[model samples]
Target: MASRSLADFSHPQDFILSILQASPSTRDSRSYLSSFAPPVSVESPSQTPALDVLPDSVPDSASSSAPRTPKPANPLVASLLNPIIRRPALVKIQGPFTDAQLNSIARGMAQLQKLGLVSVIVVDRDDIPVSEPSDAASASRQRTLVLRDVERLVHFLGRHRAPARPILATVARLAGEEEDDTAAEEEKRTPGEVFVEREGLDHIRRAVEEGEIPVLLPVALDPGCRSRRTGADKVLGALASSMSSAAPSTSASGRRTNLTPLRLLVINREGGIPSYARAGLPHLSINLASELDYIRGTFLPQWSHTHPTALSNLALANACLQHMPREASALVVSHRSPAAMIANLITNKPAHSASLPHALLVESEGRVTRDTPTLIRRGLPVRVLRSLAEVDIPRLTALLEKSFRRTLSAEGFYRRLETDLDFVIVIGDYAGAAVVTREDDGTEEGICYLDKFAVLPSHQGDGTVDFLWVALRDETYGLGLADASNPSIGSLSGKGRGRDLVWRSRADNPVNKWYFERSNGFTKSADGKWKMFWCDAEQRLREKAKEAGREFGGGRLARIVEDEERGRLDRWAPVIQSIKSAWV
Candidate 1:
């Protein structure tokens, strides 16, 4: 009836309005538009009307169809031609999330199906429990909290890799939607029952192996995403039986011992489940540098330390950390601050893992040094070049090649540094130079990153780095940060207020101990490639924020344990090789 081509409107509402007005007669439109929804999924980015996914009201005729007798099919190709696709079974489905939020997850699941993964079973919101009363106001508030929880769950799921790859396997239970206290207790797993989960997992393993069908059995390791719709024993039992016709049996670690438990990762912000469950499960506790910002910005800014959401979220994170398994991976998304907090967390006792979760701390290049304060008087005259185009690039490249054993590309370097960079700091007549940028990664703004800090081998052991660090700090923090009263002498005084600095270094470097001492905090990432460090002169920063009349918290940070660091060597390889070829 309407001629609204697919190209016109991005908003669905606008498209619908145009269609309604396009036709004068509305009589046969309903019959025309109400086409039957697809059997597998009812939705896509398309011109057709959207439908529910396998509506319960309409039974799946495909499942009900009798198994057809085999024809004289070729032996080798028969299986491929008629592969038995298992309807993906889901267990332990529960969520306090709103319809819109849950729909996002459904979209993610649908995306997987579109990628050739199939048969995802999801629990409806009607089945989930809520702590608040069934009033419109209470429901609205609950939806907001649930939405936050779902967002974190989605982000974490999107990241799970390696041992926990495809974390959407069969593991979960929706909590009972009950009003009684006993029903609530039924939602929890006591210490002894934690053992049952282990046993159940073993049973599922046996069932999986006996039948060669590939199945995904994901277990939500954190509180926010854990389900009580079915007990672990029941869920795993269901999984085993679904994969194999035989009943699940008592089992132990055998050939399947190497199988890593599927981790449905989640960020715990609501203090949802108690500490006991976490300590018993094979779960990891991740702490990003940005949490401190959330504590400062959203929790502390314009609010006291006693704020419920802020306080509880922080407390929950700490509690989870205490229970982290000895070798469990710790994820650290980069943030420019948290130096003081990180220092407090690091431990020297080798047996105890430095009180840090498998120590994947992030440090960037050109973090400050003890030489900073002294460099104020004796520092090299460093030149700040805003753009490389302003400098003699070939000269700088030749100088870089002599020291770092790599060739540098002027064009590639400029493109990557274009926006976030502050200025290129060159010192000592081209003996050393550093690329500085304010990567506003978290809640607070202008979190500094020393993207590249290179020095000539001739100046290696000299005080060049010391002078550079001091210059960097002086330029960033301003004179007021060093001395608040006059606020007129240093780099940041007249310009915009400065943010914190972060950098990373090769883990094998001998000077790490020196860095460890000079830095507020440091951590080796889980992948063991680089050691990241940060600075948290919190007192000075608070004063600076006060002066600037800006709130100082929330790093807008991410949990970047691996993705951010991946292929860093590849990106720098060409330049390094060029330097070696041209200079060496």
Candidate 2:
């Protein structure tokens, strides 16, 4: 009906073969002439036959025979399909870069800029680039980029590169060589030069040795920031070892000589002091010029200023003691201020120069007055008083009496007085009490005793007890009993004459001991026990008159004889005779 298309062919392979047979590239008349018919022999060939030529047309029995062409390599396809290939311009490397590689990159960059080909030389992470060199104006811009990008480029390159291994043997060799150089340098330095250079390090080392404070140092590199590094653990380990070596030894011999912590204070009496200064007042200055003179001359030179003022007081005191002259003593005189009181106590200086005694306490009655003249006449030096009637009078009397008792007790006097002596006399209700007794020969001897006396805790602030003491001293003196030359029991004791006043508390009274330094009566042996004494007969009669409800006046002494004649003198005949003569 119409011309048949190639699709209408009964066999497509046969149609394509027919087309190939008719093509000139495949047709060969020479091969067709040689193999016009089929092979006759059935035997196999010894060698394989090679095809020499293609036939020009299909044979009657081989209608489908044809030839094929080989395909060419596709450059475009390979580039488009390969996954590993990257654009040359997009190549980048992260850092930190080696010095050598950085230098190389710098050279390569200069070369690129010289070629005038590179438009932009970018650093991938920061996305900034060095400009290509072109005109003079362009060169200026490129120079700016070079300055900014050089360091960054080196850093980026270093990060991407693997760390180089250190040559241990080479480093060791170099260090060995440097040892001589170090020795020479050290030899050149003077002792002072060396000290100056090492002052800070030495200070830190000494602080460590003293166990004063903790030392901290950075130790490792931070991964987030490449520029930062830390201290080596090895260095820390060495420090720890040093600290252990410097630690205070616990053995008896190795222990620190002065293990006790010293307490100190510095006071500025002039104005401009802060309110906070009051808290530290306890450690403040003693009347350094007057009271602490011996200390200033002796011990303070050796003491180091290592602590705050609060911690230096005891050290200063100790130094004061150490430096005192052999012929000098320290005496502390205190005023009303607690700071002054504490400073005086800590110094613990003596009163007299000839004795060179270690310490002394001088109780003053405020500013010296007509009454104080009597004390001065008794060979007592002037001292500042803390209180008129409360602390000063009572405390002075108590301290004197206590010292007297202590001396007597230490000399084995009190034990003998208990039996060998006759009757005891308590001159005043205050610490000024005395024990008067008759010796075996009928002569009267007096033993001044210091008994611990205290104001009741509730009555301490009322000043009642203090006023009572002053009145008692005045009344006793008015009676002619206060004179050291008088025959009163306290004055009669030549050993404690003019210094016969003692104050203490009963051993059973807990509050008394809590407030007082030591609760024991005047002597060390008086501790934790009741103190009793033997007194003369006159003193006994006075006690009985008071017991019989006599008032505190000479009328009471007048009644003592009547009460004693009735029967009281029977037990106190020896004491009565010895002391009665003195009273008459």
* Clash count for each candidate, listed in order shown: 35, 44
Tens-place lDDT per residue, model 1, 213-234, is: 1223223232344432232223
lDDT of 2 by residue, 31-70 (tens): 2211221222223223221111101111111111112242
Q: Over 4 Å off in model 1, which ranges? A: 1-379, 440-446, 477-479, 483-496, 537-584
Per-prediction TM-score, please? 0.28, 0.16
Which prediction has the highest TM-score against the true structure?
1
lDDT of each: 0.33, 0.23
Residue 324's lDDT within candidate 1 is: 32
lDDT of 2: 0.23
Please state the error at residue 51 of candidate 1 in Å.
54
